[model samples]
Target: MEYNIDLQIDKQSLIETKSFLIKIGNKESNWLGDVSIHHQATDKFRLLEAVLLDHRLNVVRKIKAKDVYTKNADSRSTFFDDHLEDKFSLRHNQFPYYIKYSYRIIKRDFLFLAYWIPQYYSNVSTISSSLSLTRPMDYEIHLDSIGEFTYSSTRAAGLITEKWSIKQPKKIGKADFSPPATESLQQISIVPSDINYGVKGSHASWEDFGEWVANLNSGLDLLPEEEIATLKKKFGHIEDQDTLIKKLYHHLQDNTRYINVSLDIGGMKPHPAEYVLINKYGDCKALTIYMKALLNAFGIPSFYTLVESGSNPKSIRENFPSQQFDHVILCVPTKSDTIWLENTVSYLPYNYLGSFTQNRKALLVNKGGSQLVKTPALTHTDVHQTNTYHLTFEGDRLTGTLYSKLKGEDYEKIAYVETNLSSQEKKKYCHKYFNNQGFELIDLTIHQNSRSLPEVELTAQIDLPKHLRQVGPLRIISLPASTMPASEVFKDRTRPVRLMMPIDAHDKVIIDSSQNWTWKLPENFSLISEFGTYQITYELVNNSPVINRRISLGSRDIPIENTAELYTFLLEIETYESSAPIIPTH
Candidate 1:
């Protein structure tokens, strides 16, 4: 069944106010299924209306009929839940669920222009069938007229049966556009009372913590004296628990290889420490728990810390424990440095935490109990690199040599790539890197130093087509590549753009020319032609020449129905050129 939806929003205030409206609908084949609409609300706000559109018969059902005041007190609303499964027909050719809500401030001065922001699925889902939006709706305040505003939008739709289509809303105006400085508007601090700390497994009492350690030792089948002596030495240093914990953590980190292969049952519980020792590889949880047990054997206090491994974005839940943590490490407090051990990575330098684990809240679980602590940040000195390259041009052929000095994570990335790739595969990879300039590489080579702060140097010889150069008199002459014409590429012929080559990060490129050529031609080549340098930088460099010769042309922006014209425009440009030769008449 086909459907059409129209949504509108309007707001008027004594001063300035921030307001928005959202409309969401879903189409499914079956009539009985769950529909979820979750949103956060606040006091002094209103949820104006929510209507369902029965497109087949063109009827609208008022599912929620309440004034703004009745719904203002609660900060959450569930329009539909499990109870509503039998109440509404959720099958095909039925009413489409639609929701539209707007809010305004009754008190305080609202100083900023309002916007309608849309968040599609974070990851694409294959179950959506259709998704689209007309121009996004937005209201902007003009600089000269502070109180006045402008608004515009059309309709948007998302439809699905078996697959999903996700389209995030486009920004209505310039993101950086803002009103002039105003002292009345203050930055708001939004702090939620509840943060998700993730789920907890079956707990062992504090007294059982030691027993758990003893069981782990026996289960690993470790040598009796080796285990006992190791435990005694670790426990013997009671004067400094922090140092003992750090030592145990370092031991675990040094011995373990961080491979993220999780068995179903092992994901929830730690792997046997003996298995980890034999395999030398385990996921974050396994390694972290193993470290904790080792610390316990030594009588040092340590804990397993669980947190998501990435930029620590704010959590959306109000009071739920965080269940989204993907990585685990260890935290031990010493008298000198509060040591945070990321046992998942074996190559990382001691006392160094990359940005992936920095400044995020993690749950620390130990016999002393679980609590939240923030991981430390990485400094500039921890991971830095310097790159340098030299290029020389012979005719249209270019040869270059590149060198990179890497530290920290940069070195690890290079080492991993080198170990995994074969010599021929590395050459193909270098070809793509040089192909960024639309050139073909003739030969490529890679060299590396296996010592401290590993470095990879790449050298390549490439061919830059001679047609890219320009010659001129009254009309500029250029030879574009067989793939495209200069006019089509430089569609906006009003200005010229500069060209730049991409080098590695922190790298410098020096171009050297072995020979220079200048030409003096006949009377036909002599004319009053103006020439100057052209330079503009967009996302990348666009430096191709322009010719003023007249040629037969086709329409611009061909319509979709004219498939032949579109194909001709795309394929015919390669064959376009002057068919006649230039001749001088006396």
Candidate 2:
């Protein structure tokens, strides 16, 4: 794949002329045959030309990008479609073909000058790529890049011309638990030092960017007189600040839903609190501002926070700050501690950010300008979970009741199951959760301890069809597959290990049989290392064996050299718990 881009910046708009040359190597790379150009609703786009060429480099056909498709049709992720794609499809019969297409986009409201990524997809090699950018001599911009590239610049006719090129890019090997591409990929980011996103703003620094955000959202938190009266009438009597905050947060959740409104500065600027109050729906930004307004009604102060929120969020370029955040949250400071609220999600417990927004730096926008602050980080204990099973073996079958207590991300999973799934869907989910080990789920129940705390309890009664497996002359109890086995997950890892959160889990099992069945107690095992720790114990009580196990791995970015040790630890755990051998007394 090769990309040739020319960017011209002026006071009114930024114009980008982009051309792509993609070679389809096989059936897997056939997706390159289709061309897609993405742009916001505010931008003007035009496709100049598209041509399909054979392996011999002769033009076979010409295509046009006439179809416009909405960017996201999934209602679950996007309530309101905010972007469009200009698509050109070229169907070819032969492999090793080439597709060339070029287009132009005029961006009137943009936060960043350019985000040039030469290699957009994984496992795809780039032959050559180049960028020619021109801007006014007085305009100041900052450039940040990862990986190797060549750069050159010149000044002529009161304009600065900058050229960047990447040739024969090296391959990045896949690895288990690798960091996000933004952290590891070869890319370039260009940020302007000042102005223009429908309104005046600055991208010179984090503080400047945040102050611009504050100014954009200024006076958007004002509530109507009646709304203020209603709020006071509902929660004015609550003297405790925490209780008040919870009440207000709950009110916001109950009253509003999330939608995307990208009309304002291409969704960079949020709609006002009054809009949400009247419409009962808003995007993350609007919902956060609404919550802020609700808190401010009672003289409580909160900062509108911007964060790159996701399971594995893109790395934030803190030094060259631009509009990098995709989600908006609210940060409230109280007497005892600070509270972070994810206003878009009604299912999340109050003040809980979960794994989506936790353990990351966020920009707080306030009257005092912007400040960077770290969100709450979870330790192994924070995500602790326990599973207990009481089992009885009769003939070749096993019946048992399992109870699970989940916290942190585990709690979030079960919470989602409880909130989103139906009775039949939950049953199917439980079967999959148990690794589909031929266990018949007789009964399953999900329980939430409280609405304030993010925790869940699950009780399930299951019957294993054939619990006993005869190996030679002995019977062994077949166990569910390990969640992360070394062979499947940690094998041939080339990248450094990066964990988003720590893991701490415990398991206990009590085995009894109506028939006189005895089992040899396996020797206890324990291992501790820098990667993590593992321990398992066995006890004999009333001719039955009670087993307990615990595993913990701290959250950290470990280098590739240390992953071998971790892989060995995981291998040992996998070998030790493969099956349980049993002896039947006649």
* Model 2 per-residue lDDT tens digits across residues 392-493: 877666789988888888788778777768988876787787646566788888888788877788898988665667667766675444334354466667
lDDT of 1 at 437: 47
TM-score of 1: 0.42
Best by lDDT: 2
Model 2: CA > 4 A from native? 65-76, 422-424, 436-440, 465-467, 478-488, 579-586
lDDT string, candidate 1, 113-183, tens digits: 22112222222222211212122134222211112112333334432111112233222221111111220
| Local distance difference test, candidate 1 | 0.39
Report the poorest 10 consecutive residues by lDDT, candidate 2.
66-75
lDDT of each: 0.39, 0.80
**Model 1 steric clash total:** 17
Q: How well does candidate 1 score on lDDT at residue 222?
A: 32
